[model samples]
Target: MNKKGMAASLLTAVMLVSAGCGGSDTAGTGDKGGADSGSASGPKKVVFWHAMGGANTKVVDQLVADYNASQDKIKVEAVFQGSYDDLLSKLKASMGTKEGPSVVQMYEIGSRFMIDSKMVTPMQNFIDADKYDLTQLEPNITGYYTFNDKLFSMPFNTSNPVLYYNKDLFKAAGLDPEKPPATYEEFQKAAEAISKTGKATGGNFAIYGWFMEQFFANQGAEYINNGNGRKELATQSLVNSEAGVQTLTWWKNMVDSKAMNNLGRKTDDSKKAFSAGQVGMILDSTAALKGLVDSSKGKFEVGTGFLPKPANAKDGGVVVGGASLWIMNDRADDEQKATWDFIKFLTSPKEQAYWHINTGYFPITKKAYDEQSVKDNMKNFPQFQTAVDQLHQTKLNTATQGAVMGVFPEARQIVEGAIEEVLNNKKSPKDALDAAAKDISSKIEKYNKTVK
Candidate 1:
């Protein structure tokens, strides 16, 4: 059969499976409890699927409860959908049916795929229809969701990578604990100094592609071709370029010098190493600050700093890393309207400040910083200010805006494998990166064809 025929068949199968599944009929039932009817007997129920768990789940639950209590017209039910990958898979399986949630929290890498799925109503649609003011939100945070002069989703649980260091270890190494490394060279020097003391490993960054992505952004380099996939659909990966090579080479040298521990790709393992005082420094997300601080309470003093950049790069910036909320298009008009109201409530200044305080994620709204609760929280945990300052310092260019591609999850896996190979001395940085790029190019080609 033709490609179009195959695509149609697949979509039909998906819709059939979705319709066969049974669940609570709370979502997409706009007529029973809609705000338009002005019925006080029951409120419209909106289902929200999210990937948050553990401590973060508590905060999300509180936000849902608060939103439900604040209004009589709408009630939201928060559902935990495992990890981001799991959530995406389930969402895909449930598309074109009433079983799907009215709204979903999708991770950054899935943004491209979500757009291509054509199952979501772009936030811009509601914004334009209502003439809603979005000037209060942070431009840098919103830039990640904006593509081709359109905003696709609402920025939520936004985060960026930051340097976390053991202040006590730095002091013991005869380095100034207050002054963290600001450049790549300075970081290397400090790493060497800490390594010489033999009390702790110099650094312990996770073998994850996110850090490499941040490094490329710091150098104003694109991760994928065609302007980080913003100008057009990217045909290939550019992660094997000069900037990428330099960044990988530096990481390799640090490992060789026993200055940085190769902690594999597990973020938890690397975080444990740092919190246990086995490593003097580490690179991790700002979302981890609260957990790290809490874990290292009696062990040592934890300090936060901006991710170091290469000396020659004048435009140093980091990509916003996290998830956003997307409203499903299959819902009723009232359900869609109710979903938008919940999204707005969640992103309001008061809620943003509360979220930032409970979780270490950055507040997407600019006015959230001016809130007294936010100001007091920042004062209590001054380390969070480092993340805030770094975000503000970031410029909204194609590089910093981050790559948008349909096969980003697969690409990240390939890159992570290359990093592991380089760290293990199985392949040189250039060789591994070249192989990974080639593999990613093939994947991207296959994905583009399937979508077309």
Candidate 2:
């Protein structure tokens, strides 16, 4: 049976289970009429669960400390909850218990699941109640979190994909390091030249589906059907479209020609290859800028450019990738209000500026860029400006806003598997992608039915 048919067959069974789960309409609102109605007697304690570690953990800790120090009404206890996948697993397991945090940080791909779970207060609820002005936020950043005309969560730590290259390698290959490729054709030419030098692989293969998504966006192509799952519940995958096939074919040819290193599906391996000067170029999230710069320090100069597109394409843009803060509906009204307050404090211009400077994540609030600290930081690390520019230049559309579906994470894995098959020569690009798309369609269909 086709994916839609399978979904239809399972809908009744899925609805039976879904009907038993509780739903929450008040996402960020506590029991109070508004955020201001939080307990007046003492500071309300709010627990925050997140997946940041290493340097990111330190930054988050400092932000929490600063927030705590700045206010006595809401004391936020930030807890590290392993990786994004780990956090999602724990969150699912804790839904039936009182152990879930009041505010949770969820990765972008989990947005659909979070909304369907009905376990949190939507930020729109709080915004409407408090008359909060969302104009201060960058539209492109907020666009990803906005679903069905409602902003579900507060965007935080947002990043975009960019091409990172070694300036030294570019110059050695007799190419202008400053003039990074603006199109895939140029990129291929540059990659070929860099490979001929034998000093490094021309490009590093990205194991994740993120690069593929970016390429699709660059081509103004949707990753899934139903307007990238924005117009309606998506029933199919579009990863086997001509644009996708072209992208995978290009990648396959690059790998076969030895212009790009096939580092498998491990992002760390690709990152290591690039940082060790074994590769000249790589496509990675802007969030890796700080670490990439630090690691490449004293070794070579690091440069960044917008993700390349087809030279003939008329329009291109990138989707925002990162986590956002959501307030759980299980908390007291005051606690929910407290969580919202903490979220506001974190997204404030000063705090966002601090975050943008310390961590490589892009500032969501527009005013954050106006801060002197952010300005000076950009001056020091000019590479960050490329990301900022790329975001501003992005044309907002369903394809660029990113796909929204409960099974997005699974869909990503399916795409990765398809990429692996093509890279390993087990299947042609079209065949591999067609199979993956079918699998994703089945998963999406099942998820949509299960949730409804």
Candidate 3:
């Protein structure tokens, strides 16, 4: 849902979905870069290229305006490249070239790939080099953006998946809106009841269900393993695990039982069924809140809540999702200084609050959460609180830390396709998952061997 995971790099919907949350990405308060950080004797100017659109990107423009007005020491120029691929291609082409921006916005799944490239400087170095105060920030939020023992990027547009429900459907189905679904049994019952209404083809619980690995992930299962070769890598696919099978099975059964509809699904689906009120409930990226709200056009009431629990649920916490800001190097001294200053400014509590209010993404800084401005805005609109509440509910792990692999997007494709076969009655859930595990293992092994 959030444009930060494997989907962010591979799926177009998730990336543009972020654009709906806030203003378009644009130039910052500092000057555009022609030189590097500085000459070790003068101010620096830097250019930052990102893939933000609409209002979400515009926030960057205003911030840049303010930064430029505030100081003469550094100047930053922010540019909105096309999509994730566009930015990546631009970055790839800029490598070793003089015409390159000093900062870039990267989606999460793209992180490890970039880290492997070794063309950019880690933000930990940036923070240490400047002595920025990262301690005041929420460690968990930043953890989602970190890799290895060092940080290559600072957090921005962070969010987790959430269950968005249609209250009217719940009421029509004779279910309590306040009690959507908290347990596995209850969720099934709700779907069954909604299906009984014959609103459409059975009852459809909308989302990128096949692609969203939240259930097993939330339960703390391994999507990848410690492998340096094919055997270990193949053994670690984890799709055959009890939790993994259970997760995939539940969805297949839901579709077979006519409690959920499997319709028009592909590699990338907009889930127009849910937003158009053709379905009852959906678990989507919190970053899509604004778009969902805008798309609804006030026809039906939107209810937001945490994902439901499992049958013998031993855990109830969720995981983090979304993207981060990466620093691109090769700038002169003045540009580096400007990029550094602007980077620090972007994470400030004030700006964080603005980003949260203007966009539904979570603020990375603790101060942003407690700031009166943020609290007041959330007070006026409580649904925003639901996302924040889920923050404490999630305890991070590999499943939730997200599948950091070279071919995760492909692995996801394998799994998602396997599930679709089951739902489409082309195969049984058990058989589908087994086959998916095999296909995924093959790719995982290929990727694992390539990794250092």
Candidate 4:
């Protein structure tokens, strides 16, 4: 058969399997609880599994409750399933069973794995069927979730990394509070000055692997081969490339020069240090802006800046760092549709505005900015405008779109281990990155083989 014919046949088979997963259900049957309808007296139900914890959990619960109350045709039950890693693992364990979630919220790095599993109904399918307008959403956010010219998931809460600094510390160190560092050298200088002045340690960055990936993108460097895995399955890891070496070397030098503190792997620890005025600057997600602002309220002033890059680099930007919502294929058509409805409601401009102010995550829809609440939020918390400006100024490219691999979660852990190895003097920058690249490449090969 020709390529087009083969593609059509594969799609038919996939659809058939998906249909079969729902079991037999008579159309227009209200007595049975399958795709056709719910109980004889109520609406269809959708089980949504998510990973929002702590104070965020209450916000999620409220959203779910509001969604449930808004309509009687569909009732969504949102369940908090621990961290992102835990949620993905639990989904894996429940696959091919009758107890799986109808919809799941997965992190950005899990995209390849979710697609490879073939257990999700692509959001593009619903968009096409419903004639949904994708233009209203943030182009960069949708770009991150689009693969093979298809949007696999609906972007719910999207964010990118930013530089968080203490304005008081900057002023005390004889530096301009308004001028946050934009490049590596400037950041290094500021850090050293702050540390030397006894105001605070220059900075404290959590040894999070996401930072390395962001750094790579900021340099217009790909993390994996095959167009950052968007063109095709990535067969190699580029964690040892020039950009990677430069990133690690710079980080290690900061630690060695006492300009930055290596605050282990927990971002919370670094956040705490900064909040306590023990650290002048730290790197964190835009989602943390609200919390930092609230925590630093009267004690000190907080400032945000774009993620720093090398001085000479001019063509790169940070990748999206949050999660998206996916529809599970095993769910009944009614359940899936109800889930999609809930998703649409959640991403609506008004809801997005509510989510943006209540949480630090920026709205995924451009229309959300027009909401009076969001405008007031920007006015009240101008530091958030820095992240918004940085996001809009970014240039879309293969590097900035981010790498996709079935083994991305594992790859992140491997990169984080390499960072530790370099910082602790156990290995040179080149050697550590070379080792990480080799390890991730092997894992990628294994993951590709399993998926095939």
Q: Candidate 4 clashing pairs?
A: none
Between the candidate structures 1 and 2, which one is better when assessed by lDDT? Answer: 1
| Model 3 C-alpha lDDT per residue in residues 1-452, reported as the tens digit of each score | 23123222332211222221122333233322343545545546667777666676777788788877788777677777766555655665555557667888876656656665555678888788877777878776776556665777877777777777778888888988877687667778888888899874324443243234567656665555652111122235667677767776787678778887776443113446777777787767677776776677667777788776676855535555556777665555555556767878888899888888887788888888878988897766666678787776677654555555545545655666776687777987678878887876776565544442
- Give candidates' CA RMSD values in order: 5.6, 6.8, 6.2, 7.3
TM-score for candidate 3, residues paired by index: 0.83
Tens digit per residue, CA lDDT, model 4, 197-224: 8868999889888889999999999999
- What are the lDDT figures for the candidates, one per model? 0.83, 0.81, 0.65, 0.83
Candidate 3 weakest lDDT stretch, 10 residues: 13-22
How far out, in Å, is residue 321 in model 4? 1.0
Off by over 4 Å in 3: 1-43, 199-211, 227-235, 265-271, 294-298, 332-334, 448-452
| TM, every model | 0.91, 0.90, 0.83, 0.91
- Judged by lDDT against the true structure, how good is candidate 1? 0.83
Candidate 2 deviant stretches above 4 angstroms: 1-41
Over 332-433, each residue of candidate 2 has an lDDT whose tens digit, in order, gives: 887898788899899899999998888788899999888999989888889988998999999999989998877777778788889999999999999999
